[model samples]
Target chain A: MTAEIKWVFLYSLLTALATGLGALPFAFLRQVSTRGLALAESLAAGLMLGASFSLIAEGSHYGLTQTLTGGAFGGLLLLAGKRLLDGHDIQFGEIRGAGARRILLILAIMTLHSFSEGIAVGVSFGGGQKLATLITLAIAVHNIPEGLAISAVLRPQGASLLACAGWSIFSSLPQPLMAVPAFLFVETFQPVLPYGLGFAAGAMVLMVFLELLPEAYEKADSENVALWTTLALVAMVLFQTYL
Target chain B: MSSTPILSLLVAASVAALATTLGTIPLSFDLKAKRRALSAAYSVAAGIMIGAGYLLTLAGLESRPSACILGAVLGSTYSFWLRRVTGSKKFDDNDLESIPVEPKEVDRFLLQSSFHSAAEGAAIGAAAAVALPLGLFLAAALAVHNIGEGMVLTHRLYSPQATSSHPNAVPAPLLWPTSLPPAALVVVTKLPQIVLAMGTYFLIQVWPEFLPLALGFTAGALFFLTLTDLTPFAYGQGRREWVALLCSAAAALVVLGQSFFL
Candidate 1:
């Protein structure tokens, strides 16, 4: 209703939309070879690795113990979720079986993490409009790699580029949805921010080791996989540091 | 007064050498026992390395939290480079070229030894630069830690079958140069501590503020070892669930131990 709330919603929506840009690079590739897919997965694993570390670092700015404890719980939760999902045959739209399961899992994780980013955007606004705008832009830029990470997994498994982009945006939908409330109640959201960041980070890190890295290793040479993963991690960390 | 740091470096490096030597003493045992315990040992070592690195990271965070991440990136990048370079085929010439493309346990063990030694040496140097007592404490703790690592290194690298020249016979690469006698293997592996410790000493002397970054670097390197190398190798040994549990338990042990002591 208010102008400030409208702005918050709009900015958050913009951030969510930025995620679709991650899939843009996928357009340049004509076909996906096994090695290319493996490297892509490695890139995703590295991005997740860097993102998780950054999340922990950011959360530690508030409270280290809370962040780490939240990370442990987050990892456990993801593992438990994976176990539960394994019991049922999974289908996500046109995707099915293992591919469908992986898609659903990554989507669930990215969405879960976006909630923290949404709250972050909301909380930044409480500091001032200038701060809010800067944080929103940074997050929007950051979401591109995250989108790429999602598309890396989804596109190779037969999802269309359009579908991948749409799913990427969909995964980030939590930003606008959670931002309004967090902005309205900054005090309430601030305390829980670290835990949420930690949770997202923990789950993402576990997912990299459990899913992406393993798959990368299986499909490609271990040496190449390590190289791609490390390079991607270094790039992501530097990106977060500078941006 | 200025020489105290340099002097402490020698002391720390000497302690590490002694500790590592003691750790490798079990290499003389029968091969089957070592093979059986290999995965379990790696699992425990992985956990301890993570714990120790995390403790160092926490200490670094106390003064400069942000620097830890930068340090971590640098450290992990170093590890990645180390793994890449070491994994190359020309590290040595041996008859094991025809073996099935199983993971190179020899290269992994070599990287683990050198990488960890350098990281721990830097930690010792950085800590000592801050305070002699702190440096000495870390050296002693790491000395104890290196013993376990030494044990793992020897077990993984020194099996009787590894020394043979036949293509069909040698499953793993020989632990040392073929020309070098078996007795020299111990000397060669333990050599990294003195060299890396000296190098780290010079680094700290040049930049006093390198302490936190050094700690961060150590943590990052350790994490790389666990996630990229050890986890997969351990899993390959079979019983994924137990390997995971042991890794977790060892990590918890180090985390808890350091929390109380450090």
Candidate 2:
């Protein structure tokens, strides 16, 4: 293998593994308290909300014309998917298990967003070694909380520690797969990056306001929730100091 | 130049994927957190999500006012419509304390969780293509959030029905929707991120220009979620003003401060 390719792949691998490393904490805890669950949710909420917005700011590189167009398109896509699921047109009995179907539909949407990260890894390599190294480092550090986020929701749903780790890793598989190809043709792929970035950003934003935060609110009290959320945002933002 | 860059890219991506799975390994130990702790974690996660949307997604669009407005409006509007279509209701905050939940609701919740995870993975992938710095930031932020996710998902299985320690802990009132065992259901719900990660990455390389629309689309969807999905629940549960004001203020300050300083 070429030295450059070797380093790029190695860095990506390390980054991906960091996600599993983040999962280690859940293995020790056999049970959780109501208070603990709330705390965990708040933390995840903070991290996710922050990241989603950060993505938007980054996407602004292209000007609002692209941003709004991309964002609006993303929103429509989600609605289309949601409507399909919520359409409730199909009788529950017709689908073998409506629950599984619903789960699958959600999975499809999740996949739409994840594919972009893999491309990001690939694209960063095009920026050259120094830039790639920095990007890799950032992504690796970032995966830890992502791992935690997955475990946060799944653990409460009754998933095992191993399962949470496995799923968390599973969600991030795109990074390595796309890195190779994106590195091969940087110029060709450059133009589309903003739109893809915007799409992911929009989807996640909706997720926070629509899915995660509400869930957290339902789980935690309306009173202490904001404080916990603030703490998490502050913690995650701390990493930016290194930038 | 021993070989093509391809070799290195493959390895890098693989390790990144491994990190995600490895992070979950800790859940096997005997340690545990309480309900309040989980709530704290979720709250943190929520904050992170809000910060990410504004800082990365929304702010990135500042230059293009038209696109930004379009994305915001569409996202919020569609989400509103979706809620109506889904039959999902925001339980009044007044009744949040007394509301009953069942296994079916849990299943639905699991499904939704998977959806978001997949979407997040895609965000990272998309960011990588456009701006390495942005991608790095998003990825780092998400990794931190995932740790809590690992713990929270494990906590979801605990039921008041299964335990005698907390009498006041209400047993879930909503019926579990399917015949599938909880364990299996959990696995099914959690496995999609890998596919999403890989798929999104691959797609971006092949269809580069699509990213703008794609990114904007994600923003719109998220906006919708915020409007339809999270806001109601948040408003209903707490003193709306405090919850809205504090969280929004904190998130905004963090992003704006970074914009100037960073």
Candidate 3:
């Protein structure tokens, strides 16, 4: 059992690490154009949007009301967080003010999202190592795109791709942290799982609307923004659905 | 050993009414804070409503497309007229500090809420009469759904703007209980459907036809309300482009979620 638990933690960590790979594409680009940055943001929006609904759908297995109520609270939390952070002269390394706030907000949102994925990882391990591995691998693959999403928002703000990759992995650190406890107490985690999923979904949805989309629109035309958003959204949903 | 159809209908109607009433509890919370969070919350509510409306439309279309279309048109027209008569304009302010909403608007909003809830109740009663399981599922669904309706109602009708804008508007103490009356109307509207579906022999077949109409009307009203009123208000609260973008994403999310999972 201890061996199994160690494997669960390792596998979950691997998924978290996989996120950094999303920044590789950014490494290849010499300089991102304004339109390119906008498209990247749209892609991130689409991915988050797809993930939010998927989380809602998964959460519905426990109860729709539980999931939705949790979602509402999640929105409240984001709103409250924004209000609290507003007017503060925030600084992180070179990033400061609104840029720091934006990066920090998305990282916070994504990290919160990882908690649910961690729970999934932990809960799956309760089934067995095989189930755990499969779930971990899927999450790991998904995290790559999520990492790219982080880099997309971060790269435009002048963060190095390495830093983008680091932030991307950092956003997913919750998975391993959350997995062990959930695995240890699957029964206890069962009821509250939907709420966690819903909370993440709610926060991500609000972030996309309140933060990411507006920034994307600033750099490009509505048609371009909509086009990339729709395309990426459709792609992400398909990816998750099939996988 | 099995319960009668009438018994199930009564139980369903009661449960739905109770659920709706419970939903209004949030109205009791202190909404004194004037912030963009209120609008964000409203946008979130609109997203949920839009998802519900989309699902309802799909379900109605599955049964009767023509009826759904006709009901949608009527529902949209009803909403339009309600807004027009009340002279409700979009809240152009930065936050919930002050809304230009009038007292009559709240009344109209409540009227629409009752109408939608009544439709839901009728659907529950009709479904219950069809089969025990189907009825139970729908009743349970609507019971959950009405909570959201209750919240949306309180959020819009009892918003800080509604009270602050008009000094004579419904007070919190008096208006808090108003949530119950609309809930009670659910049972009232449900009783006839229960009687018609269970009491008369031939009316059971007829009741199914009304399902599409009811669902369509609810969906149409929700679509109109979310798009025209709620989404616009959300846009005015802050960045318009983001609201439009996220709103579309939300719609897509609902579409994908419903298609894949539900």
Candidate 4:
């Protein structure tokens, strides 16, 4: 096997390992407070903002017109998705059940979303190994919180730590699942690469503004929330410089 | 060309699977002592999201005046509509104290919320896979936000005993006082917001040409969240105002420092 191929495998493996390692803290420690939670959210917010800017900066090199068109298309897709999901009454806090039927329903809806992300990761790798590796690391670091959130949900149902971890891992299975095909047949799938990036960007921007920030505000003191948000914005700018 | 399609698939799948599973673990934290840590972490994540949206998404569209204007309008309108659709009457402070919650139900709610969050992450990731070449940062930002989100939601839903133990604690119950049960209201109110968020994403995907417009709209939405929603809530209690402001300034400094270094 070529060195690059070996590296790709190792990179993917490491990404997964890092994500799992991040979740280890949540397994044995269960006494997190609201304040602490808020702080963590703030840090994640900073990381995300930095990453988002990096994506756009990179995209701009492609040419203004192409980037603009991509941005517009991405924005519209996010709007439509928001409306459709709204029509279904599945907005924030919409589905809260552990029954087999409910889980199945939620899983089905989530699959569509997860698939989109996986495709994005796959296409990134198709671009170049270095760029792809960095993207993978970013994605993996972000995933740690996701794993913890999923586990928290199942904890009340007598789900063992193992079970919670299993579910958390299960949800992300699509990332690697989609990456392989895109990397192997880069040319054939090249057209979709920009679109993948756009789609992920759109969903992500929307998620942070609409869901994450609002939810954070709800839990915190309003003034504090606002002050912290501004601070968070500044932090994002700082992160951008590094990228 | 250098690798097999199957191997690539395995790599992507492994990463996704690992990220998802790891997300399920419950991180431990003390509710009181770690207030600064919690705030710092969340502020950082929030900073990432805001910075990403403006620098990456917004900056990308700076040259497109028409698109920018359109996106701003659409974003603001959508955000306002969401607020309206998911509106709930504010509960009195006294009302917040009276809401009864069962531990089992809280657990159920947390689980459900977690599932939805994962699904959201999946969707965001999948969409990035198809639309933009540099969507990894956006995905990463969302992932970070989700971790904080999971922590917040889990703590709120699971730790009644801790609250009760502290005599000085003033619990802000998670329920609305109107005839509608708070839990049900929570579910109802959040649906519209979620829809708007997800819908905005899909719209951007189909019309890649309007990426700037979409980003602008998303920015408007986030700005509203920061100014209207979060700011008011954070400062509602008068005593903590100074602390809050200081924390906020500290947060901004952290960002500025990051800009200078890594």
Winner by TM-score:
1
Cα RMSD, model 4: 21.4
Query: For all the predictions, what are the DockQ values?
Result: 0.13, 0.03, 0.05, 0.05
Measured with C-alpha atoms, the lDDT of residue B148 in candidate 2 is 45
When just chain B is superposed on the true chain B, each candidate scores a TM-score of 0.68, 0.57, 0.53, 0.52
Clashes of each: 0, 251, 0, 142
DockQ score, prediction 3: 0.05
**Cα misplacement distance, residue A111 of candidate 2 (Å):** 4.7
Model 2: residues with Cα > 4 Å off, grouped in runs: A1-3, A62-64, A85-111, A240-243, B1-262
lDDT of 1 by residue, A1-243 (tens): 499999999999999999999999988776889999898988998888768757876887777667767777877887788889988999887878877887888999999999999999999889899999999998998898999999999988888899989999999999999999999999999999989998898788667756776677667765567657755765676577657
Off by over 4 Å in 1: B1-157, B160-184, B207-229, B238-262
- Candidate numbers sorted by lDDT from highest down: 1, 3, 2, 4
Best model per DockQ: 1
Clashing pairs in 1: none
- lDDT tens digits by residue: candidate 3, B53-130: 555555665677667656665665665566555544332222343443355455444444544454444444434433
lDDT of 2: 0.51
Candidate 1 chain A: worst-modelled 10 consecutive residues by lDDT = A222-231
| lDDT for position B85 in model 3 | 56
- Chain B TM-score of model 2, please? 0.57
Candidate 3: where are CA atoms >4 Å away? B1-262
- Docking quality band of candidate 1, CAPRI definitions: incorrect
Rank candidates by DockQ, best first: 1, 3, 4, 2
